[model samples]
Target: MKYCLSFLLVSLFTSCKYFDVEKTTSEAILKEELKTFNWNDVDTYPSFSICDSLISKSEKKECFQNNLSSHILKFLQDEVIVVTQDIHDTINLQFKVSEKGDLTLLEAKVDSLTVKEIPNIYELINNSLNTLPTIYAAIKHDQYVKTEFELPMVIKVE
Candidate 1:
């Protein structure tokens, strides 16, 4: 009986290596995850339903840009933009995509001359952005994240 009890005890405590000496805390796990993540880049860019079919990152980005540009152009096509002289300028449009997949127009960099030529240019651009379809927020470290984008539009009128 003594030998059997000793054997059982020895077997129960056989390997100390199998026991975890240090418990893993949430802080440690969070730090380890942060170390593996790249803060400067997102895992996935904001996308539209039409662009979601794309697989490659470059293809997804191109699809997003093309869809955005075409939507704005289509909206503009319905309106009439008249200029007295040839106006050549680039409008820098800044946008923000929220983690919840909401698109907001942050700013529209239009020159004084362009504003003068097209008084309601800002309004037109803002309206077009507001009318855009649902956008999926960007992804980083397996979590939804907000992203900023700047798209330059060239205006050339004869």
Candidate 2:
């Protein structure tokens, strides 16, 4: 009886480590970071146009109108230029939400940006992704659903 009790105690202790382990992907990390901002609490949610037909038709017009706004358009253009110029000569970044509620960055391609620039762009993208309150609000408001989005942009030299 003593031997069985000891074995049970040992097994319990061994399994404790596994319970503490948080298995997460990069996307999840992003989502958690975004949650830190409590974007849902903000008023005047940011808006965007829906290019994806999969989104509900009722929200499509609002999404498109939001996309045409000067603020968002400038932000998108600036982000594309900064990322491509600082990270790679050719930049392609894919953003998606993981099932665990984190942002996942995939298909990152930089043909010519320096090694240092690559990390900078990654940091920039991560920062931008995390702080997007408007986008998060839009999703929560049912203007958009959680899904993979592909946006291709170019950086024009001055």
TM-scores for all candidates: the values are 0.78, 0.36
**Residue 60 displacement (Å), model 1:** 0.4
Which ten-residue region of model 1 has the weakest summed lDDT?
11-20
lDDT of 1 at 127: 88
Error of 2 at 81 (Å): 10
Model 2 lDDT at residue 135? 40
Q: Give per-residue lDDT, candidate 1, residue 143.
A: 94
Residue 71 C-alpha lDDT in model 1: 89
Clashes of 2: 9
Candidate 2 per-residue lDDT, tens place, 109-156, comes to 655444344455556555555544334323544444344544444533
TM-score of 2: 0.36
Q: Best by TM-score, which number?
A: 1
| Candidate with maximal lDDT | 1
Write down the lDDT of every candidate, Cα atoms only. 0.86, 0.50
